[model samples]
Target: MAKGLCALLWLQKLMTELSHSHDHIKHIEVDCHFIKQNLDSRVIQFPFMKSEDQLVDILIKAYSTLDKLSMQDIYAPLKGMDGLKDEDHRNLIGGVVGEVQQHFPDASFMVFNFGDQESQSQIPELLSDMPVMNYPIHHGDCPILAMEIIHHFLRAADGWLSLDEHKNMLLVHCERGGWPVLAFMLAALLLYRKESNGEEETLHLIYNKAPSDLLRLISPLNPLPSQLRYLHYIATSNVHSEGCLRYKSLTLDSVILRFIPCLDAEVGCHLMFNISGRDPHNLTDKTPTVLFSAPERGKDIKQYKQADHKLVKVDIHCPVQGDVVLECMRVRAGLEHGETLFRVMFNTAYLLENNLMLGLDQMDVTWDRQNQYSRAFSAEITFLEMNPAAS
Candidate 1:
């Protein structure tokens, strides 16, 4: 995978040079340089693989003939069917199910629909004989909440997939604009089954299965940071455990923003923070609470000048537990609305250090121009204390 990624980076670099557009390469420039340095120093090398033998083809290219043939046969009945109409959609689904039954007579099928109630109801009545589970998820949903929901999903999905004695088939369906949640679920399943290891890589691989612009079109704000955070949780924690996962209590002392980005206003920028997480005091409440919000009502919003200093500090001291999401936004002078500068999400149960530091590339930024912020743009979150608890 490392070699494949290196090859991809090299290709991206070449494309950027040919197109003379640096926009697409900014995010990966550091990585490309690192890979180049390693190669120059003979520390690492990418061995060439024949096109026919390249396993990465499964991820980047179309499926093999056998796999495509199987899929076509199962979904042959739905050929040329219009997907926009409700009647057509229902018939298409039913026809596909009928085709599946014809192809695999003894196979048991399960449908997991990641869509809203309205979309779930659109499932054909013909599938009444098969098990259909509905798990509705909205766009830009809270990562912590998504984590809990994914836990339940993994339990049920894994149970069906593990039944080796019977030929079981799992069909995952999602409504329009449900790709984010669907991608996250697929990545989690890969990690749970030990088929993939790295959280970022697995998540990116799944998302790359679709068009590059699909995610941006579906979601305005970048969801990868929060998604990656949850992916890290899935990779590190034991989701198969019987009870709720234990989380340690921690206090966020302060946030230090270094090499702050230059804003359009001359008066600098007003920084507002919103920290949310599972209720530390109420274990039964599954909903996340706003642990802290800066610039309280009637209180003055502090403005920090980027040219004055290299570091900006915001004291939070908010108590948080379980999964935590910290978001920072920069408001221009005289403007009520603010753009999110970056977001960080993590679970207290997996905190092995007193502080969490993230570089520019590691965070989710709303801006497109990376040159506006210094390469040193980063955030450091200090933890005052952590109460160690059993896993």
Candidate 2:
């Protein structure tokens, strides 16, 4: 009777051990399913390795008793596998500039501004030795100056930074680092990644790498632009003559002119111009008084075609030394001088060409139209040159 009782007790203990083993197996399956779901969604990947080979390697591979136990303790926490989180690098939150500088000491920064003259004037002093490029509100009249600033930065500065031997160079803006800055950053990263890694990869990243929520950090007074228009031009425009700035439907009479001096390199800025006319269907090369030049066909006064409704182009070449002047000769149908505003549009492509110098803004005068040179009015204004600290 005693012998039979002892045998029954041993069988019961074996059964309990098997039940625990089955529960452990079920838990592992649940963890793996979660990981697979994340991976399929392009969220993350798992680096595979046996737990024993990982933190527990001390036990199996080590000859020393202390090393074996140490490895086991380290690996103990990692026994339950888990998924990794995604990285959002572009969010501006919590003094990220300071944190980035700590990792990349030699990182450089550039600040571009047109509307913020006072703040812009002070940037060079604040970020000494770093570059600050400014675009003046030119012609006091045109709307397309924004596009000119975009092209210059991308073609000249964007390409050269990677080769500058600086590890952590950065470009920072105030509340609204949208439009111009975003386009450049995206293009720069895309170009960098393409050169660093061949096109083929297991995954496509960067679509959501920028942190959206952190934009709340910018003060309400400042807001990023809604769309990145300059990059849109780079991705779309036709190649025009060396010094020719071309765009579709250029309402030459209503363009704005901005004078930007000392834009960094040959293409130190980006420019955009758009024109429109009545007879909506006849908006082509023959639209009259509109200028279009192409390198292949040489110079020709062309008419706008029905197809050329919205023309766009960019010039990377920036004239380093000279004055950019703009003048308008004509005003729309019926409006007083002060009542109607005329925007003078100039070709930035022409401005950035090598060896070209612009002395002043010009407007072709007509008896019925007013020209800039003919004006008798005069006013004194203080002009600030390059950023003081940059000097």
Candidate 3:
């Protein structure tokens, strides 16, 4: 009984921490949410920065000094920090949060010295009188997006992007979705500033997506549907080919939430029209739309409930269970037109019945030796067009 009570108590605490309103936490406040570093210095000024504004100095200066900064500079202040300095840039961003493993690590508030060249390790004889400032990044926030924004600023041609002019760019939008939108604006600038890629690649990146899906989700530039589909919240809609699979459309869980039950302002449209200097004919509408079939058109549409049942191929081996069996299934809903829509979902109740992890997040077959998902698994429902009827 005591052990059970302890377990219950632990669960409650975890729930509280997970659901805590970020607004209540000042760190998660719009201005500080993006930077994960915790700073608590008492009026101790570096040679190049104001006492209280050391972080701003570090951030703005970092842009100009990125090419000059060595691995030693990034970690000089984080002395006691574990982990190798050579982690990938993605991990490097997470390192700011201190917990590198979590997709969204907990926010951190820390302070380390800047420009302590004498104390700096890993730098043999690199010379620098470069200005250094304390910078902050939130581990709990999206670091990859943050990195992209930083690079965008560095690579941008506009004088304003240099922070030398737009000194307060970081504080532009300090609201829930606003800060992220600022990042998207930077990222979008990076994409179109080149004015490169073909239309298909552009749409694919927008709808199908990239590692920086967070930027894509809240942004209002999806030109594919022109309107968000309201009824069915989402579909994988992946087209498979060539010994490997990739999403043809930039679609993901983050993308699904772009439009749904509710949508906020047209921040994306604003960026598209104003910053990019592009006409906003298609990306401006801010609401998800609905389509209803008219009775007149319904008579011409033939629906096939059952087209065929194709087993979902796992493309993996599973340890066979004596009495328990699992099967992959597929169902097709053929519309009156040429397009055939397929709905696919897990067929077994075994997962829920046994309290196993649903494994919904992993898009491809996963194999693990530990935890509930030790067995490899992945399944999908695909839709394709058959034959076109003359209009």
Candidate 4:
């Protein structure tokens, strides 16, 4: 719905020009002018309609709502069923297939399973009535792999759903712990299809579909920021291209944390960072490396004493490239352990203005820690250099 009003106006103008020689052109032009005047005078309003409530879809496409499906088992009885008989699982899947087929007698079904490898492997046998594609997504980490999965899923889903036939139905399924990745995938798909607009709106809309505790139960670390970063990637990506922008090497000069949350009283709040991603030095490894970690071995980084309006700058000077994950953690007093305060993930190729500024609302944090930080809390990453050849 980005520039929705402009698009509507353009359509009206195009229709008017198409019938310029006809007598009806005069009526069309007058109607267009009327619409503009009413819009300007606040007599007419165009509100954003959710994807489900878009009535125009019925006029353009088939009347059935069975074209796309989303299945997230909130209770997740099927997950971790190592001891359950295979027949039991098959019966459960068969019941779902029976229901869908009963509802749309002429429809064809395709299943996209986002789960563990073992669980995904069983999908084909369980639901032999349709085609099943497995996309195993690792949780807790590996943002690079997740991005690749998203790109592939978007392309595959778009190709299948764009067919001229009316009976094509797609069902996206995920297990108990797969909600985080599934949410990200669904948001990316919605944005790709232009059914939803804007990164935050699209992402939050998908997450809001599930129960409030679904994400927190699956992931200890809030994955929204990292997911939002990928959503932005999808928004800016070219549909005809093989992939996103080419990877580029860059130097992370420093990170500035504003409104640092106070965890300790005496020594103030000690902070640490862990930045990991595909190596800029060797891209073929496929394994992410720790590009940077503050308070290395015996060294100590600066701490912010006052919790209010405090800014702490940590110099990184680390070389990184392609799908980076940056995590900020608060170190406890006299303890080696530190808890993650927030995380930000992004690709070097997608950097704009040579920096990334993330506010408190955008960064991934636990619910308890969310309200503790000020609304102005932000993390700014500044890059010192970029490879000219790669750019």
Best by TM-score: 4
lDDT of candidate 3? 0.24
* Candidate 2 per-residue C-alpha lDDT over 168-253 given as tens digits, one digit per residue, 9 for 90 to 100: 23343332223223323344334333332321120112212233333232212111111222223344443222343443221112
lDDT of 3 by residue, 234-286 (tens): 11211111222211211011001111111113211100000011111222431
TM-score of each: 0.70, 0.31, 0.20, 0.72
Model 2 C-alpha RMSD vs. true structure (Å) is 22.5
RMSD (CA, angstroms), candidate 4: 10.0
Give the poorly placed runs of model 2, Cα more than 4 Å off.
1-97, 106-115, 118-120, 136-145, 164-168, 175-230, 238-391
- For each candidate, the alpha-carbon lDDT, in order, equals 0.67, 0.31, 0.24, 0.68
Q: Which rank order by TM-score, best down to worst?
A: 4, 1, 2, 3
Worst 10 residues of 3 by lDDT: 268-277
Looking at model 2, residue 16 earns an lDDT score of: 46
lDDT of 4 by residue, 177-267 (tens): 6667767777787788877789888778667666667677677767777777778778877844775567768988899988776545566
lDDT of 3 at 129: 24
Model 4's number of clashes is 0
